[model samples]
Target chain A: MSKRKLTIAVTGLNNTDNPGPGIPVIRGLRDSEEFEVRIIGLAYENLEPGIYMHDIVDKTYQIPYPSAGTEVLLARLEYINSIEKIDVLIPNFDAELNTFMRSADKLKKMGIRTFLPTLEQYEERHKSVLPEYGEKYDVRVPKSKAIFNASDIYSLNDDFTYPVMVKGKFYDAFIAYNTEQVKMHFNKISSKWGLPVIIQEFVKGVEVNVVALGDGKGNVVGAVPMRKQFITDKGKAWAGITLKDDKMLEQTQKIFSATKWRGGMELELIKTNDGKYYLIEINPRLPAWVYLAVGAGQNLPEALVKLALGEDVKPYENYQVGKLFIRYSYDLICDIAEFEQLSTFGEL
Target chain B: MNINRNIAISDTGFVFDPSSGDSYSLNPVGTEIIQLLKKQKTIEEIQVEIVSKYEVDDVQLEKDIIDFILTLEQYNLIENNE
Candidate 1:
């Protein structure tokens, strides 16, 4: 039987200490039995490691940053698509999702398909608006408020106790024990990720996560829950195990049903001592540990590509429980010629 | 009085619960108690075995055994208290 050949372009290829989902997403696609894939890595920087991984990424093209705006990004994609004829595009970064989503139709016209959340679905689930999202979706969430100014930190004690969480809009979070610490975190987060930093009441518990895919019409294609066995100082899961957690799966389904969410999502949840789950945040894309879902039998990234191509996908009923995924770092030795090629010519 | 049937306990005191994928290490006493429980030994039989092997008083051994059982229960290694 001949497998369908696909040209899939993926972004967020910075597989560093703070890894991106691109490499893992590419791994899932490469593992697909139904598809023979030609992976085109869309990288924003010359140093993205995925560009150097020749065996994994057939070709790598340096694209403009999201800071350059959607027009510049769409123009770049048009140029890349003219050559590769990309069948499906997967954007794996939180910071760049907006640009790709905004240009989804333009990419479609250019013959590139993308499976992504709608702008409304994207905005409401932002960390700043998560409180209302939890309420609207009927999910339990920690008490939180988005504050725009440093003075707001002084009055936070009236609503929240000390040892609260100070979070940025896009990334970065710090546990602040006092007003001074909150102000410091606020300045640091604001300078990097911009304003409306969120202050959340810290919930003490074990952190468990669910990676799930939703087919725009409220059907969940796959879901896998995992608990971190080891954590890095950056709070990324170093090692994790797939869990037999029905509640987490149910919550993920409920969120999909309520929102009619499209594309891939990761739910960051806290399970308390009393066994209640709190929805901490919703990442609008596949996580770096998403390959664990593939190892556990869901193959969400493959399902996502199939869904993008308008294929009828049967919802995955079950995944292998107790599957473990441990992440490791390895250095890839390459000559400076490869680096020079990517830097000078933009495509390698 | 019952350990989860799916649990794999080693002679060297390593306990692996297949259902939850949680692994635990046990001391010699915990290992002995868990092994006896896996064999469907009654609480009274376990108490007798511990008292005969260790130089501990009956009342103290009973208290210690109950505490040990509760700890196992907390870890969800035990099936049902009944």
Candidate 2:
């Protein structure tokens, strides 16, 4: 008997210096022996390298940016569906996931499936509300506060000290050594991403991350912990190696159980000198380094696709530890005509 | 304005600066402007050529070209003699 071929559409195709997880997720799907995949690459920019990587993307279409609202996005998806008929959609950007989550039911009615966390689950784990989340879940989180204006930085002396982490609501974070730097980052981030900027106590420790999938029923389908070996100036993991830490695995399971979280999530943790794990941020979607999880034996993206398709997927019990992933930039030669076509026609 | 001689730029807009070990990806318009800079074209000449080829007007092209050049200068991909 032959396995079925699936048409999966994925977003966040900007595989640049600061990459998205789409290419890595597609790689996981391509590596699956149980399913053959035809990938539809959804991109926001013409130069998203995945759009030109024909080996990975069967077709590429430019969608409206998330700021365009859900109506425009759904209309674009409808047109794409009329032509390609995508079976599943995996939106990989944090900025876009809210629109997807809100439109998930409409997408299902249009025959497009997605396995994503509920709106409540997504909201509760947001960076702004993470302090309360930690309290509710009994997790150790750094003291943090969300401020709407730069003037609030002056008042942070009560709960925070100098060298606190200044974070935007949606993206960007900087370690500020003084109030001036805090104001600078606050204005910079607020102007771009809008605020309530987050001020957090800087936890001195090694940074670690966990990529895990939940069954939405208090079960962790798969989990892998990795310590970043090399970090880029932008603070992305340039290289990472898996770790065999039972405590990390236990924490992942506990978070899943506590939140009943559905779909893929990345938990960023700071392990202090005293060996305590401090939850830093929770990304509702897979991280850019998810390919490392696939290499380590848990093909999470494949299992996620199956779960979205209403298939019963057994929870992965074990993965090979000590697998290393070193990310390198490759120059993909492409023609200007291809770029012109996609930029003009919004499809290639 | 002169492009850094050590910078290697592919047609696909992948830029590698050997001196800094930093790589960058650019859009088509950005790549075209960099190619023009590499050919030692004056800013006015580059703007005229781009405006004639692309769907942009001279005014918009002028502004865009200046912004692009400033970005290149910030990234240390170009040498500003001025």
Candidate 2 lDDT by residue in tens digits, A45-100: 88999999999999999999989999999999999999988999999999999999
For B40-62, candidate 2 gives per-residue lDDT tens digits of: 99999998888778787778888
True contacts kept of 2: 0.00
Q: Highest TM-score among the candidates is held by which one?
A: 1
Runs in model 1 deviating more than 4 A are B1-13, B17-21, B27-29, B38-41, B48-64, B79-82
In terms of DockQ, the best-performing candidate is: 1
**Evaluated against the true chain A, what TM-score does chain A of model 2 have?**
0.99
* Top candidate, metric lDDT: 1
Q: lDDT by residue for model 1 over A1-348, one digit each (tens)? A: 899999999998999988999999999999999999999999999888899999899999999989998898888888998899999999999999998898999889998999999999999999999889988889999999999989898999899998999999988989999999999999999999999999999999888999999999998999999888898888899898888777888899899998999999999999887789999999999999999999989899999999999998999999987789988998998899999998999999
Question: What is chain B's TM-score across the candidates, in the order shown?
Answer: 0.91, 0.93
Candidate 1 docking category?
acceptable
Native-contact fraction for each model? 0.35, 0.00
